[model samples]
Structures are given as C-alpha cells and as structure tokens.
Target: MQRVYISDTNIWIDFGQAGLLDALFELPFTFVSTDIVVDELNNPAPAGLLERGLVVETLAEEAVEQLFTLMAEHGNSSLADVSCYLIAKMQGLPLLTGDGRLRKQAAKDGVQVHGALWLLDQLVAHDIVTKAHAAAALQTMLDAGARLPPVDCAHRLAAWRT
Candidate 1:
C-alpha cells in the first residue's frame, strides 16, 4: 500500500510556486489534505492538486472540536495548520508543512513532520524525478521565496549536482 501523508497549505504553495506540482504528484504516495487546507489553498492549486489525485478529507465533528482545542493551545498555528496536524496525528500519517510554528507543535504532539526538502529527496529516491531535476526544483523553490533551511538546501544542491 502507498503511504499516506497529510499536507498543510504552505507545502502546496511552495511546490506550486516552484512549478513542481506535477513532479510532486509523480511521487509514489497518497497525498491527503484536510478540507480546511484545501479551502485555504488559492485558485488553480486546489483544482490542480485534486486533478492530480490529492485527497480532500472531511474531518469528523469531534475532530473539528479538537482542532479548535489545538488552536487554543497552539495559538501560532492557523486553523488549517491545526487541521493538518490533527488529521496526521489521528491517522498516524506524516505531515508535510513548512510552517515553523506548526512543526514545533506537531513535534510536541509526537506527530512526524516533514517539509519541501524531504519531499524533494523522496522524489529523487523514488526515481520519480532525477537528481538534477530535484536540484532544479529546490532552486526554483528558493527563487520563489520558499523559506527552506538554507544550509540543508545548499547541502542537497551540492550533493544532487554530482
């Protein structure tokens, strides 16, 4: 079975801006998102992602209440962010988020979290994208103002260039 991963809003924006949305969907995993996260994404992105097989999950009422509770505890996280975290936690799925606050909160809750760089690595490791292609995607993300870790980005860029 393909692994399922829950993605928040920022990761979508990062890949969309990087023009790597097509490449992202090429990866061998089932990508899911909360309804809130899908609603949060701007035009073309939501449609494009859905067409690429992005699953939009509607949370249960109890889960929605938990989302609000989580929001109260982690004030820095948006509703959409908390929604992704909650779903990931409940389903034992890894979370894809580039938000620092969300990452910290997810860590506190024992939810595994990853970002764009990890996704890029996955693409290369799965042979869905070439090393050079992954490098270019990373560069494009950087050029599009993605707030990825510079050192990690540099390390991957250097290694993937080989």
Candidate 2:
C-alpha cells in the first residue's frame, strides 16, 4: 500500500509553481490534504490535481476541535497549516509542509515533517523524474521565490547538476 501524507498549502503551491504537479502524483505515495488547504490553492491547480489522484479529506468534528487547539498554541500558524499538522498527527502520517513554524511545531509534537526539497528528492529516488529534471525544477522553484533552505537547495542543485 502506498503511504499517505498530509500536505500543507505552501508545499502544494511549491510543487504547482515548479510545474511538477503531475510528477508529484507519480510518486509511490498518496498525497492528501484537508479541504481547507485545497481551498487555499489557486483555481486550475486544484481541479487538475484532483483528477491526478490528490485526496481531499474533510476534517471530523473532533479533529476540528484539535485543530483549534493547535492554532491557539501556535499563534503564528495558519488554520490550514495547523489542520495539516493535526490531521497528520491524527492519522499517524508524515506531514508535507514548507512552513518553518508548522515544521517546528510538528517536530515538537512527534509528527514527521518534510518540505519541497525532500519531495524533489523523492521524485528522483522513485525514478519518477530524472536528476536533471529535478535540478531544473528546483532551480525554477527557487527562481519563482520559493523560500527553501539555501544550503539544502545548493547541495541538491550541485549534485543534480551533473
């Protein structure tokens, strides 16, 4: 069975902007997000992604309460981000998020967290995309103002440049 991951809005935007939205679903995992996160997406991406196997989950009442609790605790985090963390926690799934605050909080709560670079690495590792393709996409994301870690991006950029 493919592992399911709860994704945050920013990570979705990162993949969408990098033009790897189709490649994202080609990986050997299932990507899911709350409807709240889906609503945060720009028009065409959401519609296209749903057709390509993105799972949209609606939060249950109990989970919604927990989401509120997380939002209050992490005052700087958005409801959508907190929802991602909460859902990942509830489902025991890893979280795909690019928000530093959400990542930090998820770590504190024992939730596994990953960002865009990690997703790119997955694409290459799974043979869903070539090294050169990954490198170009990474550069495109960076060029489009993605706020990924400088050192990690640099390392991947250098290694994948071959």
Cα lDDT tens digits, model 1, 1-162, are 688999988889888877778888878788999999888888446888999999999999989988888898887788998899888998989999988888998888898999999999988898888999889888988997889999999999999999
lDDT of each: 0.89, 0.88
For candidate 2, the TM-score is 0.93
- Give the Å shift of residue 32 in candidate 1: 0.4
Stretches off by above 4 angstroms in model 1 are none
Residue-by-residue lDDT tens digits, candidate 2, 1-162: 788999988888877877898899988889898998888878336888788998989998888888878888887888888888888988899999988888888899899999999999999999999999999999998998888999999999999998
C-alpha RMSD of each candidate structure in angstroms: 1.5, 1.4
TM-score of each: 0.92, 0.93
Task: Give every collision pair in model 1.
Answer: none
Model 1, position 113, has a per-residue lDDT of 94
Q: Which regions of candidate 2 deviate over 4 angstroms?
A: none
Question: Worst lDDT window (10 residues) for model 1?
Answer: 39-48
